[model samples]
Target: MDGSITGHRPRAAAPVGADGLAARRGEAVERAALPAARRPGTAGSESDTPAANALDGMPRQRTARAAAATPTALSAGTVANATAPVPSALSADPAAASGAPAPSAAPARARRPGSPAARAAQAVGRLLPTPFGTPFTFGYALVLTVTSYVAGHADPAVVRALHQASSTDVAHLVRYPVAVLFASALWIVGGILSPYAAGFLLVLTALERRIGGVRAAGVFLLGHVVATLATEVPVGLAVWAGHLPGSSLHRFDYGISFGVAASVGALAGLLSPWLRWPLLALFGSVLAEGLILLDDPMTNWGHLLALALGVATWPLVRRAARARAAAPTAAAA
Candidate 1:
């Protein structure tokens, strides 16, 4: 009987109190001393990956599919960094933007009539648009205002000479096209209180707010130049053909009415359909009524032409309005 009792009760069990605690504590100490790679969450885990399994003599080909499906830490990280979403407000409310007032950040209060916003809304025309954004209006209006005062006080002869020099008459345009074309727009022939002057201030400011200063200026200039040529060219042609008298070439033709008409037309494009049609009808009625007496048929016809030209710019002004609306806050400018 070569028998050695198989296991003599598996060495007496460790005591619950002293030796057991010491042994468990030592095991933890040994584990803590091991290198990081051998620790949980460290690299080179004995995973089911082919690369890891290859160490145990599996085929290298075994890892191809796994490698593709589960990106390695290094490659996956490269992709993650490249594809990470940019940080954003993650909010749909417009109040979250930098320039906008954040919701619930301020105490709840009623809007007061005395507040700056309310006062700004109530400001009269000409000053309606903020100066910084509407440079064309600011500089041009200042120049016009000064000129109006000078022209009112200057000798009759001098005022006549200046207007003659700036008039888009056939003779002046032939002699100095650039000078008269630009100078003609720099006056309010009826003074600043004229209906056309008021129209200029109101229409242009509204236009500047919607489509910006540059665009407003463009619309105005387009109208002024087109209408001037339209009305003057016919006279020039008639004179050359001996139909109009030579005195027709010296005809006085200057005003901001053309530009105002155009701005009104462009502004109409940015209005709602309800407002658009009414505005056109009212403006058209005023223009048509101006011809009832037929005292200045050519001039009245030019006004109608300029207004039509403005109405034609609907597509352009609408695009600008849409662009401004896309901004988080398109203040005046």
Candidate 2:
């Protein structure tokens, strides 16, 4: 009975070798893990080791899956602690970490004085609209008036010689010659000639620049000739019929100023939409002077004739302008 009992006890304990060892090891592990498990930091944790070390040796997939199973509150700290090894290299170059080059310092800009832009600005300043708002055409018309005074005093033969000249010669010498010969003559006389010439040159120069010198001269002559014929033919016929007493002998005695003035007057009307006031002022002055002061020596016919010629020539001028605009485009193509 003692042998049987001893043998049964050993056999029962024999079954507990490797399996028993494993069971004991597991029990010892649980006992060893008991302190960490019971610890305040790890209390109630299924894992005996801290989360960091448990994940260290684990397969990445299982670790990620386990991490995903954790609440979001724990996930943030877990992810931060996991990536703690990566911050040192990133801090070396913030730009490199962002995958871009560091910006270089910008170079300083250079300044230029007396440049073309400066010159253009200066020119614009000079050409700025004036407070008095005198149109350039008024000044040029005054030049024609001065020219009239010169041609008025010229010997009748000299007037005829000038009038009889070829159109080519007349056109070539018209404005400048009259300005120089007649306008300067008035200046030398120390009258209102300086203002007249200044006004004339300013207006004519601006007009010529705008329309081109050749075209401006042509328009000036065209208006002038039209006015002259209108003014002179009537006066001449009246004189020949003996209804009026003077200047059948010479149309130039009043000078060609009327024609020039008419040309300028026409240009003024064309350029300025606000022509009514100016034209009225001009005609009113003549009427007032004729009535009150100078007894109306000047005729309004020339101005009217000029306006008519200008209005008539508008179609031609518009065609020319269109042609000029088309020229560059045609050439480019």
Off by over 4 Å in 1: 1-127, 329-333
lDDT of 2 by residue, 1-333 (tens): 655555344233234477766776555434333334442224465543567345432222223344345354253566678734443464777775665666677876777579898899977644432323333444444655564565568797884565433111222233334442232222211223543344345544544544545565676666555554464556656766888766343322233344344345445544656864575467546534544553223245554555456556655655665676688799999
lDDT tens digits by residue: candidate 1, 1-333: 578776557465445677767775555444344444553223564444545644532222313344345433235456767754334476666554443555576787876568787667677533554578677776777888887887898998999988888899999989999889999887897887788876776778888988888899999999999998999999999999999999999988887888888888989988899999999999999999988879777888888999999999999899988897777465645
Off by over 4 Å in 2: 1-196, 246-248, 251-256, 269-299, 318-333
Superposed Cα deviation of residue 143, candidate 2 (Å): 13
TM accuracy, model 1: 0.63
* Predicted structure with the largest TM-score when compared to the true one: 1
Every model's TM-score = 0.63, 0.40
Candidate closest to the true structure, highest lDDT: 1
Please give the range of 10 consecutive residues that has the lowest summed lDDT in model 2.
181-190
